[model samples]
Target: MSPKILVVLSSHDKLGDTGKQTGWYLPEFAHPYYKLEGKADMTIISPKGGAAPLDPSSVEMFKEDAEASKFLKEKEALWTNTDKLSNYLGKADQYDGIFYVGGHGPMFDLATDSDSQQLIKEFYEAGKVTSAVCHGPAAFVNVKLSDGSYLVKDQEITAFTNTEEDQVGLSSAMPFMLETKLQENGAKIVKADQPWGVKVVQSGKGGKLITGQNPASAAGIGEAILAAL
Candidate 1:
């Protein structure tokens, strides 16, 4: 059977107290979906399992990318009706991997949702590929392995960096610094040369942990997941 991939998104739409709207970044999902579509069966899910909101800026960014536009027009059903994160916590064995699409939103819900934490732990401990891009790595903040150690402990990873967060002007608005939290949890973090640079990390052959630096790393991370699978 083709590998089954679970794509997780954040249902939260508010961007801190800034009063701005946010959710999953469109191309982060669109780029990866298109790249993984034929190779794997993907199910998009959120904490509440309804229409996952799109970051307004990402929607605008989609206009310049043909792949993202194609996904928007043709793949609405997948993202519109997602499964509940609660429904897959114990049953994650059905999925060969999980991919988290980033946006300012994940920093709110996915970062601290108990169910999301449990699910990430399940996938990681099961030796299944666990991939996240940009703020998607927010989901890793509180995940603990079966042995009670952080899943990211001693792992080399990357996410939306502190500098990039400040560059995007959301530094003060986030609940916490994503890169700092990952570092606190013992991740040997590496960053790219600049804000939008692509940085995809795949541990080793058949390695289960995969992460991308920012939006620019989405497609590259998707390809890494395929190879890991």
Candidate 2:
């Protein structure tokens, strides 16, 4: 049987009162979804249960990207009609793994959502794959395992870096710095050599905790997830 993966997206659309619309980054989800499509069956879900917002900037920036464009047109319903994350909380057995696609939005919602945290904990403790990219790792910031240790605790990981956040000039707008929070949670975080460079870290029990540095690492994160699975 094909691996069944649950793809989680952020429901928050507002970008920290910056008056900018933000949601999941297009390429971050787009690239990985396609990479894992034939290999794994996926179900998309979010906190709000519908229309996982797409960051406008990511849409505009990738206007010419064939993969992103194709995904938006062909798989629009997958994102726009996401189911409720809460519905899957105790149903981790249905999925082989869970994946998070990053945008500034996850920093606002998924990071603190109790349901999201619980689901991650269930997956992690069950020895299942748990992965994220860019701001997606924000969801890991507050996910404590059964022993009260943060899920990222003592794990090697990577996410949108503090420098990249500042470079993009939205550091102050975020509720907290993602990379810093992950580090504070005891994750030995690493990053790419340069901003926007592709970097994916797979560490934790059985290397099932996979994370990517930025949008550039989306496909790599998917590849890592497949390897871990």
- Report every candidate's CA lDDT: 0.89, 0.93
What are the root-mean-square deviations of the candidates from the true structure over C-alphas?
Answer: 1.3, 0.8
Worst 10 residues of 2 by lDDT: 220-229
| Segments of candidate 2 deviating more than 4 angstroms | none
lDDT of 2 by residue, 1-229 (tens): 9999999999999998889999999999999988888999999999999888999999899999999999988988898889999999898888899999999999999999999999999999888999999999999999998988888888999999999999999998999999889888898989999999999998888889899999899989988988777
Q: Against the hidden reference, what TM-scores do the models get?
A: 0.96, 0.98
Candidate 2 achieves a global lDDT of 0.93
- For 75-188, candidate 1 gives per-residue lDDT tens digits of 888778998989998877898999999999999999889999999888887889999999999999788888999878888888999999998888999999999999999999
The clash count of every prediction, one per candidate, is 0, 0
Model 2 TM-score relative to the real fold: 0.98
Top-TM-score candidate index:
2
**Candidate 1 colliding pairs, count:** 0
